[model samples]
Target: MTDYKLTEYSHKAGCGCKIAPADLEKILSQRSGTSFKELLVGNNSNDDAAVWDLGTGMSVINTVDFFMPIVNDAYDFGRIASANAISDIYAMGGKPIFANALLGWPMETLPLELAGKVMDGARKICEDAGIPIAGGHSIDSKEPLFGLTVTGLVRTENLKRNNTPEIGDVLILTKQLGTGILGTAIKRKAAKEEHAKAAIDSMCKLNSVGAALSQITEVHALTDVTGFGLLGHLMELCSNQVSAEIVWSQVPSFPFLDEYLALNIMPDNTTRNWNSHELKVDGLIDLKAFQVLNDPQTSGGLLISVAPSKVNEVMALLNADGLNHAAIIGAILPKQSKTVLIK
Candidate 1:
């Protein structure tokens, strides 16, 4: 049975319901920008968070992420949403110390206790992260929305960015993909109970283990794969100096991917992700293989680039901590016009 008495709504759910890619592109193209440098990190590349240099060893990483209900249960939705927001801080190799709530509630429709459960869920997760939910603002809205604005601290030298993948660095993903697809399936009432549970577990899982890897000093770059999917995140890592080759068979995913594909439960973001790639994806072993690359993830795992020699050691550490999903999905290739090829 569902947990909330949510009314019929007009808009789509979560940030996943964002404007279509082509329309959004046209809008962003007309916007002018400067003084972005003051922001240590911003949404320029659709990254998970923003950062600002605070001078000395201190820097403030600020990110505000909010979305509608991804799960049927109000408390679980809140927990997953909070975990998704806090992940941005961990992605930057920083520890979150504080967070403020961002909410859009329709109290006239949904029960207040349901909202209380949301706060309780957020509070529990914050307690685990050792961060306080200081305070926040809310407004009545047509649809439900909730998330957090988090603040974290990282040393200058330890700040990790998505754009810094070094040539020859191996790509490591800490969590499996296909959550967005499965979530969509849940909304459509086509998802199996076990599959939906697995996807929810992945989305709610924290990236703190990956963040702790910064102590190794050899992990080159770090970023969480969320709305952008794996391919989009890889493109953000690629530049004139770096190219990549990801093994399709080697990429980890939820066991139900083939089953879900058979059901045609794919989300709208999947095609949008594939269309974002101008360069052709070569060595396409299977169409479904390529399609998985565009499967939008929610609160997905950290995609890390590390020195080849250090790969085994890092994997050993992650595995020792029971992070078996942390595996080398691909390796950085020599500079090429096409940033990625799936084999």
Candidate 2:
């Protein structure tokens, strides 16, 4: 077996490599397009996945996501990437039926055996999700990358959106934050074993709970926090109808995140994330808090907005599903010039 560190081969870890929000928007803005009435959800909304109405009371959800390794283990990297890709479907309140593997390899650098292990790891996750890898395409590339293009089905009425939060809605986050910070620590060999394990465990978790939450009409808006971080994703929920007020102390985060932050260990994407939308943030009370909020997350968690009356029910469902760290982090308020207000 070849002993290789996957993270060493990649310039950026996981979603940390995503194009900065500002740059992406600029690229997307240049394209003028004809609208399709059947396209329920598309780029205009910055939604997790594109939904096409099937016109039979069901909709087809499609999304593709791929990224470079964030961990040293080939198997773990595969699992995380697969989970991250499939999360978009769950975020749209759909059940994934099948997926097509997406792989890129540095043929001269990494051994094929390690790549096979990556596929095996992704296969295990597909099995757990009760889906099959129907087909895929591969390419020779500079770095080893893996993910999936998932297809899902959802009742039209059950489809959740990232831009539908209403005033008085409560925000519930399904997992703790700080994966980006921990990932940076891992690359620098500065993280404790327990902290690394925590990050990997969180990334490996599926966000299928978002689909389940769709059954409750009170779930006004749903999105999985990924490369953009919690605040970035929350801003999507706020849209134009309302703004968010987050109680900084109530947000769920890794136990030793402060230790990593204190050492100045942070992802490169953190600054890009803040700069993209900092103009719309209010009450920037703590610098560390601001950085943590902007830290890119890989396969992080679901950020849900639910009607205030259903907060208890939503929390109960999350806890019953074993999301113990899930928390009611904030609430929606009347639209303000600022997108988010942190206390």
Q: TM-score winner among the candidates?
A: 2
lDDT of 1 by residue, 157-230 (tens): 78888878778899999888888778777777777888878887777777787557766677888888887678
- Per-residue lDDT, model 1, residue 178, is 84
Q: What is the lDDT of candidate 2?
A: 0.91
lDDT of 2 by residue, 1-343 (tens): 7689898899999889899888998989965599999999887779999999999999999999999998989999989999999999999999999999999999999999889989988998888788999999999999989999999999999999999988998999999999999999988889899889999999998888877898999898899999998888887888766899999999999989888888889999999999999999998779888878999999989999899889888888899888999998999999888999999
List where candidate 2 sits over 4 angstroms from the true fold: none
Alpha-carbon shift of residue 191 in model 2 (angstroms) = 1.7
What TM-score, computed on C-alpha atoms, does each candidate reach?
0.92, 0.98
* Candidate 1 Cα outliers beyond 4 Å, as residue runs: 1-11, 19-26, 30-38, 43-46, 278-280
